[model samples]
Target: MSYLRISDTVVETYRIVHYEQTNFLNRLHGGDMLFFLVETGMLSATKVAKGTSLLASLDDVVFKKPVKLGDIIRVRAETVYIGNTSLEVEINAFNQNEEVVSAYATYVKVDDLLRPVPVGVKIVEENEEEKRKIEEIKKRRESKLSKIADRQKMRFRTEDITEGIRYKISNVIHVSPELTYDGKIMSAGKLLKLMDDIGGVVCFNYIGYNNSTDYTSGAVVTVAVKGLTFYSPIRLNDIITIRAGLIYVGNTSADVIINVIREDMKGLKEHVATAYFTYVRIDKEGKPIKMPKYIPVTDREKNLYEEALLRRGLRK
Candidate 1:
């Protein structure tokens, strides 16, 4: 327990030997499989937080490849940074062939009422590699982030105020038609891989973090995938974009809206999937973490937002 830090856990290094982890295409389901990746990260956070960490916020997550039912899956998690009360964890799930299949988020610590709480976290001594990792994180947070909260709220905010930034998740799928059993071009699992990869990039890769972090590392807080959806067949060379914006911030978590759009196709640009996932901010032990007070919404964000709160309810 004392060996854990804000960003260092890789619990999911197993194979998807059963059909349960896959989809109709004999591959992992985008939403279900991603959740499994998240579970590994969450457990790590909970362990490092001394069981005090709770999921507080979740940002962009995407799937990159289709994990066949028998393929090996590897999940890794690490703490990005730790504040007085909150921390961030980045989760990455890969396939047996060393290909990343999905991305996920766990949270910081929280209280019994689901409120952010600052709990004691055991920090291990930092090494040269640790120093480099932390510096890279600082640079990314400083450069890319538009000033999200060190602590977040629960509940998707109806207002748009992401500090002039919109979260984006995208995927580039170049699958062969031969892989399809029937005339179907692609399977839902493959689509999920694309989304997870894109979302992972938006969440971590773009900044710099990749591969996997150590077991002791941790993030400010962790987030989870509430749900997922897929649109028409995604063929080879399709450039897809997934954008997430602030919806609402509850006392314990932040609600975000995700939008998926395919650029390769012409004609209709339907909304592929939108979901609501809740995460608790906690320490390494799974205790809850406190969230920020408030973040002001912007008029532009609101205007660009889809205001699909009503449609979200129908996603069950």
Candidate 2:
């Protein structure tokens, strides 16, 4: 319906990674960086759509290097492609001259009732990267939509079988009104922050527990988020539970699958979101180190292990 230039939809912002943004390890928190990215991308998309938009899905987000305190992060977002009612945005985070993170996200135009509506806009490609991303936008959007369908069948078992190298972390928290937008709906960035923290702890416990006998020591850092899908929006005061565990462990890396569920009025648990985060074991010098071997014990574990390998191969 409406045509717009990519330049007109671009948004750039600056952030100083201060002490509050840093983790206990003194490195910039990945969650904070992602929050910045999401905010910038959403702003840009809203400008192009000329109305509110909902983030449908997040593409492959890879964190190349750690953002340190006192570092200034330059975030840039641009609309790369537009569909009938959705658009793709490419976001990048830079620390000085080095690119620290890169991501692509899909957002859908929504009406006042929060229903999908036509964006009525077109993105004007201004570079080779933009052209290349445009060609794959449709495929990515399709894949994201498929994930939405898959979420209905997604399940996270709470089996506490400790017969193998497995770790599980669960937390139930109340979604306070202060953490939400419009005083009802939870912020996607806040959810991402929780996911990152839970996923990181899962990785940490996996490494610490598996290698305790060998006295192996190292730090775990999030390298990439493969696919994170939000099936439902969280509401204020809702009690939500997050469960995360390691599905596959490689030489110096591991893949963690996290599921978020909320309790309905009938006391039934409903799936809210699922995310896969890849973390690398890093030594004191920040180099990747070998991780403990993970042996699958159950049929479900075996299936998940194989699936994780397939996902890793795709990334390669």
Candidate 3:
């Protein structure tokens, strides 16, 4: 129904960081940056798809500089690759003319049932630069997949989830109109907010209510989001079920995996998204405290635990 090219779909947006977007330290919250990245990238994808698109996966992100409140953040998003039903976008954010954050993500065009559909679009490379950029992105995507495969093959040890002191929380909520775009599709920014909030709650409850006497005695702060992948789109007023559970616990840090599910007309549950968030437990004085040891039991838990360790190693 729509014919478009990447050259015409490249997106650029800007926002001024405000107090609501900053943390206690007056620095832009990692979650806020992530949400903005996805939001800006999705616009380019939608432009190319000529309609709604569902976010599939977010690539590894690196923040090079701290973004301060009142800074003007400019985000540029470009489509790097196009598949039968998907688009991969590379987005970068700059503050005060300096690059601060870089990320890439993939999204798919879908139908009412959330099944992949053809993106009615075409690409017209305008010049040699555009051609080279496409080639570069292709190689980068291939290199990233190769690294993931190599890491999996090298991993050996496994920790079971059942053996650990864990916590699980689930909530069902209706998506409000304000959280949606185009009067129907839920925005990726809202989904990120849900994940961050739920992940923090799971970590806090596991550390405070589950392990300590007074839940109000301490607090939990998100240090990073390991990864997040979306499988389907959530529509306005959709009944969504979000669940979070403890996956790994370190000396002063913990990892939680959150899943988003939606109920169909037949009452069947369908998974829409999954994300991993890392949190650090802090005392009233904002100092990290030692956490209880987590033991893994099941095979899946063991694999996740080992992978978490690997990711933590890479992060450090």
Candidate 4:
């Protein structure tokens, strides 16, 4: 493979936050922002791959500031690390020259058969500063790998859920042609938006949204998204089931686990991806408020709760 500078793989795009894209708080929805980030990242990765690149995983997504409606969002994505067949893209979203959100995504170059293929280019650092950045990326990748290994070791019995799961919601959607990128596979950005939508609903329901006298008194906003791993490709016309369940609750925030399952025409169901989203209940003034307590009773629930705690500690 030939060596290429990181600048050669950079992609920048801009969008205006429309009213339809805003949440109940009249701010840009986290999921919509996520979609923009992932889409731009994919374009950057594709430039390096010289072909199609699919999202493999996303991590360390931080929402630093809320993007208001009518604000212009500038998104920049570039290939920061290159592996044999995979590359990591760092994306930053800015408004008025100030960064509001940032995320890191991993993409795998795939061939026509949807198999992982070697990326055609390698990244070459131009200066000492670039070299130091690459070193940091390597360290973060190593830490993430170690965590993934530990997570894979955890196993839980799949029995009937006896108790402790208070807030949960599931949605079944038919993957239409518009949802796909090439009329074959669904875009990762769309999938992430769907996951966040359901995750936000779970958080709102747990915070007694239905019991409140005023429906628009408060809102649930995404604070951060932990590790999101894509296991399979969602194809066009696939009947996908997205499920979101509340796992842990803190003083002002809660963690929701979202799982996506794809069902083919043959009635075969496959686990597509799983992600953990952290949401905070905010009052009408956008101030964070205390969330209701959640107690885990089942073995699975307890395990998930502990895992959420571990993730929270790592975030700090």
TM-score leader: 4
Off by over 4 Å in 1: 1-10, 13-17, 60-62, 102-106, 122-125, 139-316
TM-score per candidate, in order? 0.46, 0.87, 0.73, 0.92
lDDT of 2 by residue, 1-316 (tens): 6677777888999999889878545788777887888888888888899888777678699998898889999999988888888878989999887899999987778886777898877776678976777777767777777656655455333233222435778788888887786787677778878888888888888777444434357878888886876666677778888888788889998888877887655566666777788888877666799987889887768878888878878544
* lDDT of all predictions: 0.47, 0.79, 0.74, 0.86
Q: Order of candidates by lDDT, top first?
A: 4, 2, 3, 1
User: Residue 145 in model 1: shift from native, Å?
Assistant: 7.1
Clashes of each: 100, 1, 3, 0
Model 4 lDDT per residue over 1-316, tens place? 6998888889999999999999766899989999999999999999888899999889989999999999999999999999889898999999998999999999999988888988867899999988998888888888776766643322121122213565788899999999999999999999999999999988877776774546554778998997887777889889988888888889888889888878888887777777899998888778998877778877778888888888778443
**RMSD of every prediction:** 18.6, 3.7, 6.3, 3.0
Return whichever of 3 and 4 wins on lDDT: 4
Q: Lowest-scoring 10 consecutive residues by lDDT in candidate 2?
A: 156-165
Task: Single out the weakest 10-residue window by summed lDDT for candidate 1.
Answer: 150-159
Look at candidate 2 and tell me the lDDT of residue 31. Answer: 79
Q: Which regions of candidate 4 deviate over 4 angstroms?
A: 146-164, 211-217, 314-316
After aligning candidate 1 to the native by TM-score, how far in Å is the CA of 76 from where it should be? Answer: 2.1
Prediction 3 TM-score vs. true: 0.73
Candidate 1 C-alpha lDDT tens digits along 57-96: 3445644444667776777777755554555566777775
